[model samples]
Target: MSEAQDDDVQEFAASLTRMKERTDRSYGQLARRLNMNTSTLHRYCAGDAVPLDFAPVERFAALCGATPQERLELHRLWILAVAARQRSRTAAAEATGTAGTPPEPAGEPVQDPVSPEPAGEPALDPVSPEPPHRPWFRRRRFLVSAAVATALLATLGSLSALPDDDRRPGASDSVEAADPPRATRPGTPRPKSTKSPSPSPKTSSSPSAGASKKSSPKPGERTEEPSKGPGQQRPPAGVPLTWSADSHVWQAGCGHDYVIARSPRQVPPPPAPQDAETWAGTQNAVHGRQTLVEVSVQGRTSTAVVLEALRVRVVGRSAPGRGSSYAMDNGCGGALTPRYFDVDLDKDRPIARPADGNDSGVTIPAMRLPYRVSAEDPEVLLIDARTKGCDCSWYLELDWSSQGRTGTVRIDDHGRPFRTTGIDGLPRYSYDTSARKWVPYS
Candidate 1:
């Protein structure tokens, strides 16, 4: 009916298309909401045909929280949109009227049956019995819009605070959904989506928003920004250590296959081969002196395998980081391995084919580490990870030929082997000193 009304209708139509794309609603779901045949609904949103009595369909647009002005324009488009296609017919009417000397050709536009005058209150005696009015709040759709707007603000703020480095993992990440794995160009900063702290329901209208988790900051410790580098291990030839884990997807263990070639992120080739005896095989020679270790993740039951080759056996004691106390028992299963197997190391106990008991158990405390392994090698390479809040010596050693490059797994104080921190040349133990942190001579 007016220039402003036309603009509103065009905008309303555009908004509808966007909403359809954002959620997972099926075509049938949308069709039910639009109250039209699914096929026809698709055509209308594409700007194909203008409908008649759009008031019914226009109400559905309310979900978008469009303004009252938008609704009015939508209604106008329903009635007058086809006018553009009927220009020739209008011209014919005017010509006939002029020839007959009709009352007034100018008033013809106002009396068109398709579109009527402004106010849209209907031209049937404007003064006769006014209709009941709708309260302002009743017409306003506030809840849905406010929720959407609030989540947007929080997401923006979260993205703004991420770090610049790569190769670090936090347990806050969700392993299942992995919220965000591939690092996007830093358009904004946010924590690892995988690091969504144990879910807490954050649905409130007041100051408290989002879920809450226990605090783990050291006395004056601050929450460090996260990095998005690939592989939990660090790259070679950097400072003390440089590591990044894709949180849930971080490559953890003694070694990985050639599939790393498929990663969109750039990575270095595998380590070169070296002394077969020193780098390839370790002796699993422990007898009558083994401890039963089993590993279970989350709340799931554990299926423990007595680390058949007790290669790196500890002869002495060790602490958080520094040490000559740590030792490797080197029991190579009569052969090398990265090969997954199930066996009982105890000969007297008769190795069960599919045994029923816990042997070597591993529970990765709370970490979003994607890579962790059970190996006894002294020199571990945790490629491309940044160290913070952890106290462990890092060693980067060259190795090859161990079960076709099975590599090595770094052991933590718990006697569990975790993935490399991506720090080349890092050791197994660490100690914080006033001047510096040092390692034992190899």
Candidate 2:
């Protein structure tokens, strides 16, 4: 391989190692979580191998809590590594002169002309209409030879009539019969084989079939009973539920809050919520006090997926970063009625609870878990996560069940954990839209 191509593979491996280190989990543990071999994972992280499919790499990055930007970069590196590996293989094959050679047949090679026919002793002319004039003794010998050949042919015909089981192994006549030729006209149906068809690998080993076999749970293992009737079928190979989350979504009236590492004079006026990510990056800011996330979920098929519950997992916690809190808006008069969930990052066991609407005095009815959604019907959720004591990194686990299978999908700020920091005593400011400048907020 060229040095540049080798470096690409190493670069991909380095990225994987960095992500693995950030997770703080052992290779064995990560392998178990990913349903892969421990040694395979090691080879990937150690630059000894590259995966042909990107699914495993993507899953590994998500498990390591890589940010969206980081994931994108990792994917690009993976592409480069895969391309380089393929090119190297092709070059090796071309150098070996076996790139497109067909494999030689097995077993002993046949003689070129089968012993050159007994020194050509007056060979018979079977196709000739008349034989040359010969002595009486020669004519007599030819007649005897014809009689012997006829008897040999009769014996061979008898052997051919015997059943296949009685025939000797490796007989020259043991070749399989070929199919009859078919017309090549367009739209003509081809003849079907008389042999029985084999079972499809996908149908026999699909996830749904495997899931059905685990109906009886093991000791101490949590299992969801199949909700389908006796005749109902399971969903296909993968999870039917799909969802997307936007962590940059705005809170209805007060706008976004960012804790930026800059003084009032150094910071610029707040940007709109849609542009919050870029703006925060420019200002070296992190989430302040609360982070609002919008999540939309639906089923990929017609089967309904039941959203059982929303669970919170805290990845890490630290003292809030020191910075000034900048509120994107001074004040606004509006309300939103989308399903809302409040998350308290300071709690020992954080959970998502239904919250009421803001600013409109509207008391939203408490919506409990077990919501159903399908391809035609989708559900949107607004999450307002707040921290009062520490800077927190966390993500959500959405539990769902459909068509006799249950699974959990991780929800995050585009592959990374959603971060929210306490801002109780930070210098707070609000943008004066009329003046287009920052002003101190109580």
Clashes of each: 77, 0
Write one digit per residue (lDDT tens) for candidate 1, span 1-442: 3455445445545655665543223334467676766546555566554455565456556644457876676566555554543454466677677545335334334223343333433343335532335222221234446668999999999878876465454422332333443323222232321111122111234434323442322211112211224553322211111112121111122221111112212222222221111111121111111121112111111211122121122222222222112112111121111111122222222221322222134221221122222111011112222222222222112111111111112222122222211222323222223423423313
TM per model? 0.20, 0.47
Looking at model 1, which ten-residue stretch has the lowest summed lDDT? 296-305
Cα lDDT, all candidates:
0.30, 0.70
Best model number under lDDT: 2
Deviating ranges (above 4 Å) for candidate 1: 1-12, 22-24, 63-69, 76-80, 88-442
Model 1 Cα RMSD, 1 decimal: 27.7
lDDT of candidate 2 over 368-430, digit per residue (tens): 689887764556777889988899999877777877767566676544677899898888999
- Top candidate when judged by TM-score against the true structure: 2
CA lDDT of 391 in candidate 1?
28
State the RMSD for candidate 2.
22.5
